[model samples]
Target: MKGRCDKKAHLTGYKAGDKLWVTDPTAAAGETLQWTKQPVPEYRADHPSSPPFLRYGHTATEYAGAAYIFGGRNEASVCNRLYRYDPYVDKWSRIAHGGMIPNARDGHAATRHGHCLYVHGGYDNDMEEFSRDLFRYDFREGVWHACALCDRWEGMHRDFHALSTVGDKLYLFGGKSDELEPYYSNRPVYDNHLYVYDPAAERWDRREAKGEAPGGRRSHSAFVIDGKLYTFGGLNCLAGEHYNTVHRYDPAANRWRLLRPHGRPPPVRRRAVACVHNGKAYIFGGTSPLIGSPMPAKSPAEEEDEPPLVDHSDLHVLEILHMAWAACGLPVPRHDGLETRPLLPRPTVGRRRPPARPKVRREVDHLRRSQSIFVRQRYGAQRPPLSDRHQ
Candidate 1:
């Protein structure tokens, strides 16, 4: 008797307990310090059990080695359904969660802590109001619970913000809100204030950080790595400006440092998803205004004249440990003695703004000067002068 054989048995997706390796195709031979896209299971158009539909403003959190995706909106309507993606099996299953599910929302923020996932702040189109309510989903119980706060957080209601978990606490960062100013106005207001929520205490505290923070933004991505928090790529809807800048926040010192990582970075976008794994941060998928075209206008008449936005499908990665090493005055490995190159500032667009260097560019220049002074103090005797070395 002959045994049955399978030709595609070796391609069983990723192994359950095996380590994953990411390679950079653009890097020179033997150089792996660059951004590269990782392979994902393809979903055919005819496949019945495909991944979630294309949407923006959804929240994805990793739990139990699987990614849980919740509420987001498409062109037609918003969603409150929950879906889970299993990488090992390369499958997406819609989770039928129990208990009181929150209303359909988009622009919300979610983060995992312990066995529960915390979700907060989104806009509900049906109600036409932004949510300040916080909800928690217990993975063990498979239920959702509404978390009640001790104090009334009237001003904390917002959407397009970022929430990150760091050392038993959740940090909420900049987002666009209409509740603060202009009296129930349609225009969104952007802010850079940092707020911290302690699950143990069940309360929130506002953090006044030192150094220049990133500009007020919405729809940005935030990640907590090694006790520090980093934010990237958000938009200022009020000014019609998008950002590809990166900022690092040290909770121990309560300071913010704008990071100008060496090499090319991602384009200006918002509503991107970012995650940190094994000393690297991976960012994927966001939308940006078309180059040389006007942004979405505020007025109804002008809004119709704006061009369609460009949706990104690219992946970029940042070397977090190398950046930290550079911050600590250590030379980057495998690059000889070459210094990290500065990121060129992006040109401002849209019709509402005058031609001028934005505040972020000025701050980056200031940080560069400060870093130069620090290098002089620490390694002036061992190394040649900056001008001499460059020449």
Candidate 2:
């Protein structure tokens, strides 16, 4: 008749710590939030189902009780393959279809409405250009349909943007564009504009939002909860800026309000995957430069050997209704004095400390000596002196 207990276990049914962590709206103020990592399913080597290759910038949309993953780039090349994951069976199956298949691309945005998946703009590496076409996959019919690029949608080409479905419409927001003016030399230009797509009428409308917007960013994650759209951490490449801030947009008011949620936030990053399940926003893997650490200009060999940014494998959850953040069993990194500091102190884009003058002079002299030796070896006595070469 006694209840069971485990001393080392974080969850048990008998004690206060035994209860499962929940984001209940009516929970007491002192309720603790915890994250539990789910177990990965295993299968035999000969099994028919297998996982997709490691990738990023792909679209994963939950539709009809399964997750459908679309095109993304891997180390070798971009792909246009589609795979479906069934959580109930813990299996993955590649889907084969016949229709106007999309090009192999990455950085595209996708969303599900009803039973179909809508995929939009991405960069096609093979074509060496950004895609502006839209494609739709009808789950019920098992066919892919390419939507016509109407004249009105001509200037809406973009990649690394967020797309979310609200009611019967789709809302697209901030992303980088090659057509936009660069904020600094040799850097990407990002946009802060909002666009709405009406599938019923096949029309696109650009909405001019009021209030202080989160200006010009790309690779940010966004999701909709209770009719409001919320966006999180993105990078402003042109300004050499990264963000960990959160912003909420109310369609009814046509306004954006920056939200300062309670608890420690994830470090500044972009290209993170975010989704809403049971009123909580879960954010996963992304990339960011080291905090307060900027690299100086280096030689081409050094630049090739060292990476400028770091990739993250941590997960963080945000309680939407409560406006609080929780981590998944990992210690949240602290950004000391970040909230009180201005962003102007950060490194400017396309700028870095030059190498010491003496080092440069030495490199130049060495290059000249090497060239003079090569000329003497090739031409022998016919070669001119170093001082007479310029004359």
Best by TM-score: 2
Cα RMSD (angstroms) for every candidate in the order listed = 17.9, 15.4
| lDDT score of residue 16 within candidate 1 | 10
- Candidate 2 regions with alpha-carbon error over 4 angstroms: 1-48, 148-155, 180-187, 294-308, 330-391
TM-score of each: 0.67, 0.68
Tens-place lDDT per residue, model 2, 1-391, is 0000111111111111112211222223324433332233343323446545555567777776667878775434456877776655546777876577777767788888888888888765444345677888888887999875624633356677888888888888877654321111122446687888888888777778987689877888898898889999987655556788999988899898899999999988876767566677777656676556643433211211112555564557799888999876543211221121222222222323333211101112456446545554554322211111100
TM-score between model 2 and native: 0.68
What is the alpha-carbon lDDT of model 2 when measured against the actual structure?
Answer: 0.60
Clashing pairs in 1: none
Error of 1 at 57 (Å): 2.2
